[model samples]
Target: MSAVPDLNTAPTLDDFESLFVNNRDLDNVRAHLSKFNPIKTMRMARMEIRHSAILAWLLNPQETHGLGDKFLKAFISEALRGHPTAMHPSALQVSQADMMDTEVRREWRHIDILLLSPANKWIFVIENKFDSGQHTNQLARYLKLVQSSFSKDDFSHIRGIFLSLWDEDPDDDRYAPINYGSICEILEQQAVSGRHPLTAEVETFVKHYLEIIREATGMSEEQKELEKLARQLYRDHRRVLDFVIEHGKATDFSFACDSVFGEGLEHGNIVEVDNERFVFNNCDASSISFLPQSWHKALGGGKLYWNGCENWAMGFPITMWISLTVDADGTSGKIRLMSEVGPASDHEFRHDLINGIQNATKTNSRLRIKFQAGAADEGRKYSKIFKKNFFNVEDVQDQERIAELIKKALKDFRPEIDAIADILPKFASYGKFGKSGE
Candidate 1:
């Protein structure tokens, strides 16, 4: 093996070129990653909801998988291990109980998976998360909802399991933290030991699921080997890799947002307010929002209303959004320039905002604002002001096309945008009205 280069030295173009030439480790890593994984191929590998569904199928004793209650028992045993004293005594008893009559429920009361066995007086409230973290006191709320629904006298052993890809401490101590590694261990044992023999088809499916979980949790032998090779390669070409990573163009949704809106701002297409430039808030990698600075002042910033540009909407009472909605196949979708009123905590303010837009349309005529029937109702949170599909699905692949389409939409809606901007300042003084939490 060649001696590792000094990482302190700055990497040149020659160093970068060396990485692409005669790099066996890099080739091996690529080949390893190219190996077929059915879960990944179907695009169900990283989806948390799908993972929960698959787990529910496996955990149900009456399910067609034919593993009986073996998987369920093993799952419970693994969750309870090393933390018996911290858990309820009845819950500890559940590990030894017959789970053949267990009923698995997914998304029950918004919980990921709920397992109920009336025969054994046991209930398992499982909250599964693959990539995301628990938010809004969801763990506590789920446990509370389950307890209220299932009476303590009937279901004496109610346990909470926080199953995640990584070790995450649940907001509620009642939830026992369990990683996907435990799940892989259970599945591997069943597949190899043949304690409860599954049919050929069933066994194959289980093994496929096992492979996905192993890869996700970094438990697969192939993944471990890849990591080893990757580390070695990094050591060999540390300076070059560091330089590339530092100067690399981001290949995420945020990059798309930057390309479209950033260029629009530069080209004088997106309007600037009071010298405050439009800022893009990336709501995860799926969606992004660039709200005008005036909207920030009108909606009392993020503290009073919604935090971040959630659901592609910019401010609370009223705002516009340039949205990209992808289809199920993940390729084709439309880019829409849309605006909405309301969906705010302040109902009175929401109604006023909607009324102002509707009245503006009558005077200006060019505003072209229209409201659906019952939009002014106090109970209604969201009312569409206007929407225009500016870009087709085919235009999404080209960055230049996206920018051009956005500019055209901005030019077309300039009058309406200006009118809305004028009306927004009036609501700035509007105090918090009605109940919170829209």
Candidate 2:
């Protein structure tokens, strides 16, 4: 009943069936076309970074992706043992439309997914963490809300899940943990089984998404073969591909951030303060700014507990730096007026600096700052403010706003930095016996 394509304009019926539709092998044309699938290449792959997207897909049972109730049941089963067998497929009556509304409360907190059933007296909270670390006991706070909202009987029925890229234990013992690998397995099983009859379109989409997950998990033989072919193709046409790639937009957020920060700050009166670390003196060489690698080394050295902060001032009793804190989604960033006293510093200096800053921050209520004396190698003590999210990268106004926030934070902290710089000399002169005012 379908009209045949004209040979000149489109592939003939025989060619289409043989080379494109029915072909299971990775042909050059298929490989090239696969790159253009936004779901496979961008949206699905990006779910590894964007937790909300993954939560939405998984929480929705009626999405007709043919994995109905399967992902949710598996996730719930993994997160909670002794869960009601009523969570099975036949007993599941999840309305994808209502599930999001019941789960997500935007004004209070941006929870990834929430599911509630009054009849069953059940509550499930899923907090999805792809790449970003928790900042301020986010899981604990969310659990508190859940407890307060429900009765003691209902509270007993609650299950908290921390969904991550890998099997990570939650900071809170209350939360059970699961990972993307489980979700990948669910999709793979659904694809293989004929139990769920899906439309051809849905099947193709699921396969594409599954491929992305497999690639991310390093389990994709298809990906390996395609990559090998790509390398050979690039070797044969290196110059042409290189030119095209050089002019293309960056696929990685860190690369874009590096390019923007490096180019924008290079014109300033900068000096290499730490040549080994590639830290630079910025703002007429008063404050210390980090080159991209230095920034990564400083912040990405360990598990990122706070937001990402990249630059700071140098030559103080405590390490004071200006840092840009980007959110998990890479949508926006805030400037952090951050400082820390590390164990590497002299014990006398550390004690003196911590004591002085603690006193100063208390009296200076104008800035509304707090002091946290953290463990040496653990979290960094910071006074972060002016939290803003910039979406439009091309907007000069957004860029200027970030610059202004950085300038304000520096201006506010200048007096403390000067005091620290002043004390460093006195402390050096008096040796380890230096008093606070000395």
Candidate 3:
């Protein structure tokens, strides 16, 4: 062990150099993490749909993974372990469901994974969310859909499983919550138990997936060791690490956004209105959102409101954003440019703004844009007034491509952009009573 450095002194150049000098442990950590994971290489590790598909394959007894109902049984057993009705006859029946007759369906009626065993009268609804949150009362809506879709007399044993990467309480209490950690343990046990031998290819794939789950859920032993070493390094060179992080290069996502929008704005390639150019400050990495200077002024100088909701990068009354969104199948994603009106604090103003835009679109064919209508009584928390997909998923990896696509989209949508911008100031001038109070 080396002697501990004094905490009272500021970190010097020597302290920073020591981090890379003869740091075999640091080198080992780097080498260990360099191992390839296919799930990550394809960029499917965090996709909820991919996880659901894999689970459906593994859970089906007829599927070629060769676990033959072992994984399903274990998963159900874990889900029902601490349930209030775990010992109920229906719950027990579900735990011991005949896997041979079970049919796993993906995206059935918009559910992530639905396992139906008509012979055993058991149905399992698994709602998997990897990186997103439950929206629109989805859990409850799924339960209601399932109940209405299936005949009660035929399917008496119905179980709803909320599967996620993190621990979250399901909106519907009847739905049992299960995390990726449980899935990791289950996979580890079955893969290593040797009771049911998987083919070499299947074994490799399972191990790879298990590695992904463990790393995501913080269950990997190697990851734990890496974290331990990292903490020790940080403690030993706290000042140096802090200094580097504070003044280091921007994050990859942030860099990409800045490169794209910053250059576009500088070159006058971005959309403009009334000589007012759109501005995108590198405030968030996940999405590039901006508004014309005049529109920002109209919306109370772009003050954030509502703290935003799921899938939204920023909270503003109205703005245009280009964000990445996953496809319905979850196999890939795309970048979409959209104009959104977020829930503003002033309910009356928000209501008037939404109506003003909707009425404008209805009368002027040139300004027509498809969007979900807000309630007449009040404004919705979030609404996309205009949307268009501009680039494929792989294009996001290249900053130049992102910049090119964004420029094209701005030019293509200039008419709609200008029309919407013209309507904003009219609504902004009206106060709580929808009369000119400005």
The candidate that achieves the highest TM-score relative to the unseen native structure: 3
Clash-forming residue pairs, model 2: 311-322, 312-321, 312-322
- Please give the distance, in angstroms, between residue 46's alpha carbon in candidate 1 and its true position after superposition: 4.2
lDDT of 2: 0.50
lDDT of 2 at 311: 29
* Candidate 1 local distance difference test against the native: 0.71
The 10 consecutive residues of candidate 2 with the worst lDDT sum are 301-310
Q: What lDDT does the true structure give each of the candidates?
A: 0.71, 0.50, 0.71
TM-score of 1: 0.56
lDDT of 3 at 369: 66
Instruction: For residues 182-272, write the lDDT of model 3, one tens digit per residue.
Output: 9988888887567678899999999899988988998888889999999998887787777777666453345656665453343213444
- Model 3: residue 417 alpha-carbon error in angstroms: 9.2
Which should have the higher lDDT, number 1 or number 2?
1
> TM-scores across all candidates?
0.56, 0.45, 0.60
Evaluate model 3: give its lDDT.
0.71
Give the residue spans of candidate 1 off by over 4 A.
1-17, 42-46, 82-96, 134-137, 151-154, 166-171, 215-218, 235-360, 363-438
Q: Which segments of candidate 3 are over 4 A away from where they belong?
A: 1-15, 43-47, 86-97, 129-138, 164-173, 249-252, 255-408, 414-438
Q: Distance (Å) between predicted and true CA of 228, model 2?
A: 4.9
Q: What is the Cα-based lDDT of residue 65 in candidate 1?
A: 89
